[model samples]
Target: MGWLQSLFSPLKKLWFRLHSAPKKRRGIYILYEDVKSCPYEDVHVLWSILVESHTLRTKV
Candidate 1:
């Protein structure tokens, strides 16, 4: 019984970690609002670069 208790303790902790929501907020809503308020040309360029790189990687 003692060994079983010890064995399950780590498993229980792992389960809690796996199921728990992230602790910190990413502030995506704030970023989206800011982008909507003042759209930037550089933002579009950066987004296009990111998309192009992603597509290039996937093609390989």
Candidate 2:
């Protein structure tokens, strides 16, 4: 029994090495910065254009 256990000790060590607890402190987070003109400017312009047309146009 002792010899059998000793024979499998290397396998047990290998399994523990493979399934060890993860070290989460070894991670990285990359941040990015961006600068651009607003894309929604067209939405506000369309709303104003529709309002101006509503005032000038005729309705039934």
Provide TM-scores for the models.
Answer: 0.49, 0.34
Query: Considering every candidate listed, which one attains the maximal TM-score?
Result: 1
TM-score of 1: 0.49
Off by over 4 Å in 1: 22-38, 54-60
lDDT of 1 by residue, 2-24 (tens): 99999999999999998998775
**Pairs that clash in candidate 2:** none
Count clashing residue pairs in model 1. 0
Model 2, poorest ten-residue lDDT window? 27-36
